[model samples]
Target: MTTLEDVLALVAIDSVSTNESALAKYVYEHLIVNSDLEVERIGDNVIARSVGLHSFRVLVAGHLDTVPGDVTASVIEGDVLHGLGACDMKGSLAGMIDLALDKTPRPVEVTWVFYAREEISRSQSGLLEIAELRPDLLVADVAVLAEPTGGRVEAGCQGTLRIKITLGGARAHTARPFTGRNAIHRLGDLLSFVALYQPREVQLEGVTYVEQLQAVSVEGGVAPNVVPDVASCVLNHRVAPDRTLDQAVQWLRDFLGELLDEQDVVEVKDWAPSASPELMNPHLTRLVEISGETPQAKVGWTDVATFREFGIPATNFGAGDPLRAHRSDEYVTTDEVNRFASVLGEWLRSTPNTSGTSI
Candidate 1:
């Protein structure tokens, strides 16, 4: 029966994703004090596990890292709790901790992973590092990521690829432009194409996942007085799971025909493909039933994809508006926090026990 006060108290400290040691220590201490869970740490990531009949394993995960932003003001309105990580995940983490503490006569074994480095690039995510060491430790029948879902189950995430498009040209003096081709000028038509291009919205596994391609950055101009020799634009593509990385690359090539040398269009980044929602699991189905909301697709990529790499299905379920997550006025409804916590507590209470028992 830990209160939101307990949750807010933790939030009061600045636990930006880059510096998660303090928060990890706090969570580690709290889990040790309130529950009979075995705790361990890898860098700043914290994991606490409790055994219950060893029938089936359930992993509850939430990143303790808050995106870098305002942390000086932590406020709680009538129903809203405002702070850096309030909605993006801290609320759900608090609820999970509360649920773990009230786990007397627990129904199923639960593992809590407060992984670090989730806000930045995936390569540095602590979850992935842990997966390499003890992959079986995270093996579970079901995993729920307490990422903000506005109380709905955000099944899975889309995959992303970042490509560098190099537009090559020879340099020449501005006064005698005929001597060399202007690489910057060559980029105009392609930029226009990108501006007017419409991304596709395809349906997968009964969910509509949208695809997007955009030029995130462009650089090549040498000087205003001279015709720039080489120009390059980095196109970041966020593709739906309907297409593989190969398909996505081919699609890009087709769209940007001859804009850059085919060989120069290299894939600078390749994340593992995304996983479709494991909505068919009975416990997950029951969770959706009790929450009384239809599930939806997550547009942005998340650590859930990292877990998917380990053959574990994951989903995002939590409270608060995701748009406000990294913004200055970040906030979450206290009521939403209370409701989400209660629903999780009830679901954990109802899990079946050993001897193939049903609660």
Candidate 2:
């Protein structure tokens, strides 16, 4: 019952953030009625699992929500599907759905997770709910998130830290500025440091991770005529997978050593741990070999970090150019869709859980 059109069909549904109620229903019904998998509805999330006590379990996951955009879509040249969510992830979801609908018996137990609110942050993510409420569902030997990776095997996403630094000074009228200190003036060193800071490139587990630090945003200035009393800047650090969240924080703080003594206030706004590579694992090694993909270090933060929390070896693999995600021209080739489904379907069917490890 699952065909190429399944991708197109999913692209048409508007699963924007927490508003994915409709799409959630469709996915639940699809798995229950069209596939032999045992399905469950946890809040707005849909999870399906295969029967039989297989030696190992594998999880296939994708988010249902997308950034706001035009949802209209269509098939193109019989090889392409275009519209919002086509590339950012709906295309992969369609492939996952097709895999779920397939009734063929497989060698390993499979679990499918269609989560919500991934377009935003992890706090609003449905995956967090599943993690907190149903940790049992996430137990798998190895997991795959069908994210937009252009059909490559991407591993070990970088960790992220967002810190807000504030400069405080005495507020005063511009006419008598000499009587008060200008907080804005103190921001120059920090801004200059960020602008000229050279990011380090570190190699971990044979994967080279190019780190990044940026002054992503600035805030403050009470009025045009008054000496600003408070000026704040937000810094985002993309740390290498080798560093944990606490380590990254200490690194950032050490970098701002004198500034801390200068009375600048620093607050950590967000911190997400990295998903270090598990290429050494037998299952992961076999997957990369079979897929013929050169393992690359994921530059951005991804849900792979979530699975990493539970010691699960997880990686990203799927169709659609990740660069094209969240764009108005987002699209995926039907040819790639078939290849995605086929590649994973075969991988799951043939790769038994013989690694002698369990989560």
TM value for model 2: 0.93
Cα-lDDT of candidate 1: 0.77
Q: Could you give candidate 1's per-residue lDDT for residues 1-359 as a string of tens digits? A: 44557668768878887788899888888888754788788788888888656677778898988888877788877557777788777888888877776656666788889888898877788888678776656878677888888888877888888887777677899999999988888888778887887979877656677777788988888987989877878887888877888888888888877766643445565555666766665677677777788888887787777777766767778876667777888777767787788777677767643332221
lDDT of 2 by residue, 223-249 (tens): 989999899999999989888778888
Clashes of 2: 1
The candidate 1 region of ten consecutive residues with least summed lDDT is 350-359
* Candidate 1 residue 187 C-alpha distance from true site, Å: 1.5
For all the candidates, what are their Cα RMSDs to the real structure?
2.9, 2.1
